[model samples]
Target: MKKKQWQGWGPGEQAEQHYLVEPRALAGGGDIRHVSEFLRACGWRDRSKPGGPLLMDSLDRSIRIAYDPFVHPGGWTIHGKATAHQEEWTAILGRQAPVEIVAGLTDALTRPRSAHAPNVWAPLQEQRWHTPPGAGHVTAVSPDGLAWMQFHQDPGGHAMWWSGAQDQQGNGWTAQFTATTPMHLVQSYAAALASPEPVMRPRGRVPHSARIRTTSVSVLPSQLSAWKQARVTAARAATSARNSWKTNRPRTTAHPHAQRGVRAHR
Candidate 1:
């Protein structure tokens, strides 16, 4: 079967440009709007005023989302408190993490799930992420065998999974997701990471961090044009949807972040 790929881009160092297909999960790409707009579409209310932190919540108030650039590694912080109907969960995406990858987690939050819906380790296992016999952790080694990802089943203190990688030059990065985050979301993330899709990046900025595993290729003019068109189409659709939503929803406190055109990874 053909593999699904995640799309993303990164900066480069070379004057003569080329495309590097890397996993956005590790390289980090996409804009903040990818998250914010999707939330709005799912009936999340924006509660931030002008010049304040971006804050939003689900209609039922079980999930809360915050984006404060002032915070270290500022990206999107999501919290789900146990309510009469749901269990507690927490997820954090660093400022540089891929919005698409994070979307998998967010999208999972909007739906109903059972405890036995799916195993988080399934996708990773398909991609060769493994747990040693009698071991409590699962791991996937990169193609080059120098980088890896790991998940701890009983990591304690809410911490469930985390991964890190570094290049020979010593640059590196690490990411973690908390327990109770929903296995479906974790499965979505793992599936994307294990996907064969080539995340596009500039040759100069090929390795955004040490953990990225990619092969460099010269971008065809056709690919660039296609990418541009897809972006334009998506932007127009989002704008139209947002406009329709604003017209129908009851008025709430004004929020400027919901209206800003700022791109996430510009």
Candidate 2:
């Protein structure tokens, strides 16, 4: 009898995946007691189990208790079994409460941005008691999800925020904070550098010294070349000395014989 070769079908022909059966939705102000009943009816565990009812009950209660709107504004909640002993509820809840509260606070603080507009600027009209008088408005910048730079006021009085790529050669940017003359100049420079349009250039070559001015003298090319050559020569000499030492190393026998000859002559 000849053996058969099986050619397996590709992924598209594979059996569809399935998930664990989800708990049926509860109705009419379901609470912890209801959740425990449902789980028991579903044959999750027997009533005699240490955590069978109490554990499920507590989790259900936690889910039902209204989370601080400031923290869980989305109204999302979760319910699940915990592995710790039934008596461990006190410790678990104590530890979990602070963490949950912190998470809620963080969510509340950050939620406004996503729910709001692309760019929003809040100008400070007056300095508060804590802040100095006329201490001007500060601007913040954010890109993607989080803010990078916080309220920083530039030399100008006007306040605004900016975001995006870092400034690099041929891709520079500037921001303005005030409308004062100096600020205007800064804005001009920023606009000039940030414009997407290519910058116009003179066809002729400009002298290097004209581009940048410095009071200190710079080394001439000839001098720099001479210095480099001198360094190379010194390094070569040092290497030769090391090689010669290795080649001319005295043998132990030769040293002993020379010492004996010197003692005999004496």
Candidate 3:
């Protein structure tokens, strides 16, 4: 059987330029939408057959959902050391992993050889939740790797909430309180809203100093230490990996028929 490849781009695009490395499960790939193809990779769909019902009742079996998820007050650029994953029940489904696996995964996540330990999870206000300044139903696989969830909102209601959590290694999960609705109205409205935006000309040039200003953000010393430690661990791991590769490389011996130098020895 052919190996499945998880890709954000198709035949014409490159992943580096397009993808923001995802968090926590450790594979590097971009977010998936129109996941019919992704479903194929996961063996959720039969590749030889056409796609089937993508209905809500069909999804809830695996997702364990909740309605009216809470929205964060504002955009939060929170940076800190990677925090431990709590085995607490989810607000939506009250979902919790088994103690042993959860603990094992937690330790592995916080183990010695990791870096990039920031976790970002702030939901923008509803007005800006699903457009350019907002995120659409941010998609992710379930913790059990069984189903996909779209943490998005609808026109008449806030359909779902999605929050992303990641470890220092860019291993991440986008947890969601998802719901499905008849999206025809939303689709139509979006189509109408897709018209060209009005062009606005600036009245005059503002003074340079007023227009731009230098700013500094204060970070906790603990956060700084954590960030630095993560980097150090990553660097050491890279060096060790290089050494191992050199040690294990196949030896290149002299050719059997190669010419030999004639020298006299005392």
Runs in model 3 deviating more than 4 A are 1-212, 255-266
Name the best candidate (by lDDT). Answer: 1
* Candidate 1 collision pairs: 5-197, 12-204, 12-205, 13-204, 13-205, 14-204, 31-264, 32-264
Instruction: Judging by TM-score against the true structure, name the best candidate.
Output: 1
Q: lDDT by residue for model 1 over 1-266, one digit each (tens)?
A: 44333254344422334555455545554555666766676667899879888898987788888877777767677888897655787776666555556666776665556567777667666766555455456667555443355766654543467754456665444556776666677777666655656666555655555556676455545566667566556645665786688699987865677556355435
Q: State candidate 1's TM-score.
A: 0.61
Which candidate would rank higher by TM-score, 1 or 3?
1
lDDT (Cα, tens digit) per residue for candidate 2, span 1-266:
44332254333443222111101000001123322333333223322344322422221242121122234212212222233422111111111121212122212211112433322232211111123335354433222111122235567644343322221222211222222212222222223222222211111211122111222223333443465466445544654675678699886565788889999999
- Give lDDT tens digits, candidate 3, residues 139-166: 4332333223345667788665443333
Report clash pairs, candidate 2. 156-178, 157-178, 158-177, 158-178
For model 3 the TM-score comes to 0.18
Reference-based lDDT, each prediction: 0.63, 0.27, 0.28
Ranking by TM-score: 1, 3, 2
List TM-score per model, in order: 0.61, 0.16, 0.18
Return the candidate ranking by lDDT, descending: 1, 3, 2
Model 2: number of backbone collisions:
4
